[model samples]
Structures are given as structure tokens and as C-alpha cells.
Target: MRWFWIDHFVEFETGRTAAAVKNVSLAEEHLHDHFLGFAVMPSSLVIEGLAQTGGLLVGEHYQFNERVVLAKVSRASFHFMARPGDSLTYQATMQDINENGAMVAGTSHMGDRLQAEIDLVFAHLPSRENDERELFDPADFLAMLRLLRLYDVGRQSDGSPLTIPAHLLQAEQAMEAATDLN
Candidate 1:
């Protein structure tokens, strides 16, 4: 099973930057066991959110052709604890990208207050052509992106709306239809 920390993207630009938000609530199961009464969000989970924000920004550069994984956390620092009713917004800016991997600097903020800063390095693992299955199910990933509303507010630096390729959309629909039949 996959777990997504970000609720949706408020801004996204290919090979550039992205901004996303995550709402912390008391109802979350993790909060129950995490220090009981003082249910502040854990620092590790906060870092995970930042990683997700940056990882996707890197993967999108290659049109998600390769598996982009968190290679290293070069740096991470937290200014304060995030409590229920707080909304953490993550901003990620790409530093560099190459055949080997990518680097991104990300920050988590609650309104104007800085909560955390993270520097991440991602390793892009190429797919083996000899493998029968596709590198990844673009369809499923597209659906997840749609659910994240990345397409809703995503735009390029020129202010034009970001558009997902038609082929990827078609692949997603086909995959969904096949699942329905089973």
C-alpha cells in the first residue's frame, strides 16, 4: 500500500518548482500513539512530506520515465512542532538534474512561519528493457496525481496552464477500464 502525505499541489512547474500542502488533524491514527496528549506531528513524517514534494518534481523532469527514489537527506532542520489544525505547506525548488539523479531544496511552512528546511538528493534508477512489464503504470500514477489535484493549479513560469500529455491520460483510462472488467 502507498501512503501520500501531501493533500494536493497548489503550484507546480516542470524542472522548476512546486508547492504543496498537508493538513494536520487530530483524527489521524498516528497522532494517537505519537506522544498521546501532545499530539504534534513527528519530525520524520514532516521530512517524508518534503521528500515526496521534491521527488515528484524531479521525476516529472523525465516525464517519470525512471524510478526516482530519495537517495540521501543532505540536510534537515525543524524550527518547531506542528500541531493539529496547522497546515504545512511545502515549497520545493530544483537545484540540478542529470542522468544520475537530481537535487532539490525544500521548505515547510505554516503560513509565514518556517517550520522545516530540507535538502534532498534523488537517485533515478533506469528501467531494464528486457523486463516484460512497463517501467511503471503511468495510468495509476496519473490517477493519483489527479487525486492530488496537481493538474488543477499547476502552471508554467510563463503563467500558462500545465497540461498532462494525452497519451498518459489515455493509458490511465485504459488501465481503469481493465480493472473494472476483472
Candidate 2:
């Protein structure tokens, strides 16, 4: 099973910026044990949430053809503890991107208060026609994007609506056909 730190995306601009929200809740299993008396969202998890937002932003830049993985956290600082009932909005802005990797500057905010700042570096795994390895199933990845409502708010650099990449669409169709065959 995949663990999603972000609940949903609220803003997305292709190859530029993205923002996602995560609602901290007492019902979460980690909150109960992370501290016996005081329930607080871990700073590590907050960084993960920011990374997820930035990672997706970077992945979409390559049309999800390249496997973008977080290479490192260059910097991270937390201002305050995120307790239950607080909503954290993570925003990521692209600092630089190229064929090899990308640099993203991100911040976490609770309403108007700044909660955390993180710097992330992502590396794009090499892909070759002969190499059949996939970091994630394309069909599942497409489904995950839909669940996040990325296309609903995403836009191209030219300000056009974002469309599903042809490769991903074909993968989803093939998966559905194989499922029907069974």
C-alpha cells in the first residue's frame, strides 16, 4: 500500500508551482503513538508532504515518463508543531529543472502562519526502450493523479488546461483490457 502524506492539491501550474493540503487529525494512527500525551504531526512527515507536492510537480513536467525520485533534502526547518485540527498547506515552487533533476523550494503553512520551509532535490531515473523497469504502474499512477484532482486545476505554461499524456492514457486502456480478459 502507498502512504499519501498530502490529501489533495489545491493549486498546480505545470513546470512552475504546486500546492497541496493535509489535514492533521487525531484519528490518525501515528498521532496516537507519536506522543503518549500530546498528539502532533511529525516534522519528518511534514517534509514528506512538501516533497510529495514538489515531486508530482516535477513528474508531470516530463509527462510522467521519467521516474522522479527525491534525491535529498537540502534544508528543512520547522516553526511550530502541527496538532490535530490544524490544516497544513504545502506549496512548492520550481527553482530549476533539467533533463537530469530538479530543485524545488517548498513551504508549509497553517493558515497564515508559516510552519516549515524545505528544499528538495529530485533525480530522474534513466529510461530506455529496452529497459522495462517501472518505478510505478502507469495505470495506478494515472488513477492517483485523478484521485488528487490534478487535472481539475492544473494548467500548462501557456495557460491551457492540462490533458492526460498519451502514454498514460494508453497504459490505462491496456490495463483495463487485460482486466476484462480475466
Estimated TM-score per prediction? Answer: 0.91, 0.95
Q: What are the C-alpha RMSDs, in order, of all predicted structures?
A: 2.0, 1.4
Model 2: residues with Cα > 4 Å off, grouped in runs: 128-130
> Over the stretch 1-182, how does candidate 2's per-residue lDDT look in tens digits?
57899999999999999999999999888999898899999899999999999999999998987889999999999999999999999999999999999999999999999999999999998777898688888999899998898988899888899999999999999999999999
lDDT of each: 0.88, 0.94
RMSD of 1: 2.0
**Residue 119 error for model 2, in Å?**
0.4
Error of 1 at 177 (Å): 4.0
Looking at model 1, residue 182 earns an lDDT score of 100
Deviation in Å, model 2, residue 88 alpha carbon: 0.6
